[model samples]
Target: MSTARQNPLSYDEAVTWIQQFSKSSIPRDQVTASFSRSSGPGGQNVNKVNSKVSLRLQLDRATWIPPHALQKLKTSPLVNKAGELQTTSDRTRSQGKNLQDCYDKLIQAIKQAVTVNRPADLEALAKIEKR
Candidate 1:
């Protein structure tokens, strides 16, 4: 398990956290991948190659994600009732490429979930109150 970032982070801190977290890799033990034959216009290649990759990240096992992000992620469509973040890729005929695509999707989803809107400034609030 990895240390998680705290909630209510400043805008700069959240940006920095996103950058650092994006570069870091998810633990392999927390992710599982399964491959199946792709269903698309590849003719025999699609029929023969099990290139479609289905990646599942067990969110409960990933203690690295911040609590705020995890809470948001739970509402995302990528997560099912099983509390797992599921992604799939059939963009390529190679299993490796498809698997990488799934990883990319997962990473993007997590980053999106972690992003928070900047808080309104106290001065701005005060000015609005004067109206």
Candidate 2:
């Protein structure tokens, strides 16, 4: 179901892809980023530079996402209360790593939205649950 090929994009590649997708599928004003202090390791530098990146996408303002895509995005765990898709990666002290991680997360989110299956009806559930 994914429009993306099976090549398995790297973090940088994924981010570029997401940016392009956003241009076509989401309003420019709907996307934003915030910097925060990263948790978990990284020593003293972590306390100084806010390496964590939070990518937010305001779904309600998006004109590009189809209705079905919007529904899937809403149900996805990636979305927050503000209807923003957030992703953070600070495993490494490097900002590049964190940025790449965020991109990968976004790519995964889109893939999820594109491929999600509808819930089965009660009759279908009954048949499966009976096993």
Candidate 3:
């Protein structure tokens, strides 16, 4: 059981924890990121600077995540028509931050789908043991 905690875990921290538990490694090459100009205001200036970040990942190419987690990811809402997982971030003006935000979103989604409820999981396993 987790001990006392004060602050909530950040997305990157959660991803790290999940990675440790799953013994998985996320490959950077598998992630493709694109930057486009942020919309609204600044007309030509907006078109010139690419502040929005878009990220794409292929589920078929994912290998490090646990099988159960992969299965969950396949059915997740993050999957697109092309069977690719996609995410974006444009709220921030900084291109770098936007890119990181996109990555964080992807990680958080995968973590949520993969992470099981410990109490419920233990209960289910206990029932199996009785049989």
RMSD per candidate (Å) reads: 3.4, 9.8, 10.1
Task: Write down the lDDT of every candidate, Cα atoms only.
Answer: 0.84, 0.68, 0.72
Residue pairs clashing, model 1:
none
Q: Candidate 2 lDDT (Cα, whole model)?
A: 0.68
Candidate 1 Cα outliers beyond 4 Å, as residue runs:
1-6, 121-131
Clashes of 3: 0
Number of the candidate with higher lDDT, 1 or 3: 1
Q: Which should have the higher TM-score, number 2 or number 3?
A: 3
> What clash pairs does model 2 have?
none
- Taking the tens digit of each residue's C-alpha lDDT, what string does model 3 give over 36-130? 88884455666678988889888888765545666777787888887778998887667888888887888787777666543356878999999
Per-model TM-score, in order, reads: 0.83, 0.62, 0.68
lDDT of 2 at 25: 52
Q: Write the per-residue lDDT of candidate 2 for residues 29-91, one digit (tens) a residue.
A: 776767788885888988998888777778777545544566778888888887777777787
**82: Cα error in model 2, Å:** 1.6
- Clashing residue pairs in all predictions, respectively, total 0, 0, 0
User: 1-131, model 1: which lDDT tens digit per residue?
Assistant: 23444464567766877898752568988898999999955779997889999999999877787777887888889997899999999987789988888989999998887787898999999999999
